[model samples]
Target: MSILKDKNILLGITAGIAAYKSAHVVRLFIKAGANVKVVMTPASKDFITPLTLSTLSKNPVYSSFTDEEDDNEVWNNHVDLGLWADVFVIAPATANTMAKMANGVCDNILLATYLSAKCPVYFAPAMDLDMYKHQSTKASFKKLTAYGNKLIPAGTGELASGLVGEGRMAEPEAIVKFIENDILVQLPLYGKRVLITAGPTYEALDPVRFIGNHSSGKMGFEIAKAASNLGAEVVLVTGPTHQKIENHLVAVKPVVSAEEMYKEVHKHFKSSHIAILSAAVADYRPKNVADQKIKKKDTTFTIELEKTKDILKSLGEIKTNQFLVGFALETNNELEHAKGKLKAKNLDLIVLNSLRDKGAGFGVSTNKVTFITANNTIIENELKSKANVAKDLMELILKQTHA
Candidate 1:
C-alpha cells in the first residue's frame, strides 16, 4: 500500500499551461487511497474547469472565497480548508503564484489557504525555461524553500512555448512518489527493521487436529500495522488467523506449528533492530505423531507430550543489541511473572495481560495491558482497542530506545 493511503491531500492549482496535468495528479492521489480536495486560483478555471476536478475528487472544488448558489453567497473558509489537510501540494505553480507565495500575497483563495496552512507544503514549478531561470523566479524558489516549503524541481521537457528544457511540472506518478518518500524519511522508525510474531502457534497431533489456543493474533497484527505506519520495515511471522493487513513495509510469513514460527522468527531476528514476540506458542507438543487420524476406540486415551522450543528465551540469550520484547499472559501474580519473564528472557520490555480482565485477550477487539520495563518500571494502561494498545507500546519502545 502507498504511504499516502488514508491521508487528506489538498491540491492547489494555478493558471499555467501545465495546470492541465493537475487532473492526473488528483486521479493518482485518489488511486493511492488519499482523500483529495482541490483549491484553484480563479483564473486557473480558464485552463481547467473546477467541475472536472470536483468530479474526480468527489469533493467540491474551491476557487473563490464566496460562491453564488440560488442567489445566496456561501463563504468558503480558507482557514478550515488549510487545517483539514494533512498535506498540501501545489502543482503547476505558475511564476505569478510562486512570487505571490514568497511575498505573502493572499489575493486568491488558494493563496489564502496556503498562507494559513500549518502542514508541509510542496510546490511543483511550471513555466517557460526563460521565466524559470529569471532572477526573480530564482529568488522566489530560494525564499519559499527557506520558509520550509518543499520544492519539487521542475523536470526537463517541452514547454507550451515549444522550447525543451526544465520548468515542466513533474509527472503525476513522480510527484506522488516524491511526497511518499519525503513523508517516510521524516518518520521516527525510518530505516529500522522490526521482527514481530503473532497469533497462536498450533502443535500438530494429527492431520485433522492440533493443539492451539484461542489467540486471534489481533494484538500482534495491530502492532505490525502500527510499526509499519511509523516507517519501520516489519517482518510479521504469524500463525493461522483471519487477520489481514496490506502495507508495503510489512512482509508477512505464514506458519502453522510452533517450530515453524520459531525458525521464521530466528531467520529475521539477527538482522532486526527490534524483535517483538507476541505469538501464543504451545509449550508442549505430542512426542509421537500419528500418520493417520486416530479413530476413537475407547472412552479414554493418552498421548505423550514434550516441551517445545522457547523462542523468546532463546533470542534473549543470544541477543546482542536488539531491543527484545515479550508477552506474558498470567492469571495470578501477573506483575511478578511478567517481571520475572522480562529478566529471565533478558527482554528489554514485557507486556502483561491477565485473562481475568474482561474485554481483553483473544478474539476481542480491546485489550488491557501493563508494560514492565527491564528496570522494573510498571505502567498500567486502561482497557483500550488493540490498535491503541499497539500504538502505546510503540511509544514506550521509542522512548526507551531513544533514551
Candidate 2:
C-alpha cells in the first residue's frame, strides 16, 4: 500500500505550459487514495481551467487569497491549508515561482502556504532547457534543497518550445513514485537494515504432532511493520503463525523449529545493524523423535526432553557492532531475571513482559513491557496494543542506534 494513502496532499501549480499536466497529477494523487487540494497561481488559470483541476481533485481550487467573484467577502486561510497538509507538492513550478519560494517572496496564496508549511515540501521544475541550466535556477535548486525541500528533477523530453532537453516536469506516475520513495528515505531508519525474529517455534514429536506455544506472532509482525514504515529494510525470521506483512521493505523467512530460526537469524545478522529477537522459541524438544505418530494408549505417558540451543545467547556471544535486543517473558522477579538475561546473553537491550499482568504475554494483542538497557537504564511502558508497543520499541531503537 502507498504511504500516501489517507494523506492530505496540498498541490501548488504555477503558470507554465506544463500547468496542463497538473490535472493528471491531481488525478494520480486521488487514485492513490490521497485527499488532494489544488492551489494555483493566478496566471496558471490561463493554461488550465480551475474547473478542470477542481473536478479532478474533488476540491475547490484556490488562486488568490479571496474569491474574485465576491468583493473580497470571503477569506482563504493559507496558514490553515499549510498546517492541514501531510505533504506539500508544487508541480510544474515555474522558474519565477521557484525564485519567489527560494527568496521568501509570498505574493500568492501558494507562496504563502509554502512559507507557512511545516510538512515536507517537494517541487518539480518545468521550464525550457536553457532556463533550467541557468546559474540563477541552479542556485534556487540548491537553496530549496538546503532548506530541506525535496526536488523532483525534471525529465529530458520535448518542451513547449521547439527544443527538447531536461526541462519537462516529471510524469504524474514518476512524481508519485518519487514522493513515496523520498518520504521513506528521509526517515531516521532509512538506511539501516533490521533483523527480527517472531512467533513460536514448533518442536515436532511426529509428522502429525508438534509442541508449540500460544504465541500468535502478532508482536513480531507489528515490529516488522513498524520498522519497515520507518524506512528500515527488515528481515523477518518467523516461526509458524498466520501473521502477514504487506510492506515491501520486509522480507519474510519462515521457520518451524528453533534450529531453523537460528540459521535464518545468523544468515542475516552480519548485515543487520539491529537484531530484535521476539520469537518464543521452545526451551526443550523431544530427545528422540518417533518414526510415526504414537497412538494414545497408556494413562500416564511421558516423552524425554532435551534443552534447545539458546539462539539469543548465541547471537549475543558473537555480537560485534550489531545492537542485540531480546525479549524475556517472566512470571516472577521479571525485572531481575530480565536484567540477568540481558547481561548473560550480552544483549544491548532486553524487553521484559510479565505473564502475571493481564492483557500481556502470549497470543493477546496488547502488551505491557519494561525496557532494560545495557547501561542499567530502565523505561516502563503502560499497556498498549502490540502495534503501539512496536512503535515505542522502534523509537527506542532509533534513539539508541542513531540510524
lDDT winner:
1
TM-score result, candidate 1: 0.97
For 1-403, candidate 1 gives per-residue lDDT tens digits of: 7788899999999999888999999999999899999999999999999999999999999999898453578899999999999999999899999999999988999999999999999999999999999999999999999999999989998989999998989998889999999999999999999999999988888899888899999999999988988899999999999999988899999999989998998899999999999999999999998899989999999989999999999999999999999999999999888888899889999999999999988899999999999888999999999999999999999999992
lDDT of each: 0.94, 0.93
Which digits, one per residue and each the tens of the lDDT, describe model 2 over residues 250-317? 89999999988888898999899999999999999988888898899999989899999999999998
> Which pairs of residues clash in candidate 2, taking residues 3 or more apart in a chain or in different chains?
none
Off by over 4 Å in 2: 1-7, 23-35, 42-61, 64-74, 103-105, 130-148, 290-293, 296-301
Q: In each prediction, how many residue pairs overlap at the backbone (N, C-alpha, C within less than 3 A)? A: 0, 0
- Give candidate 2's error at residue 138 in angstroms: 5.0
Tell how far residue 15 is off in model 1, in angstroms: 1.2
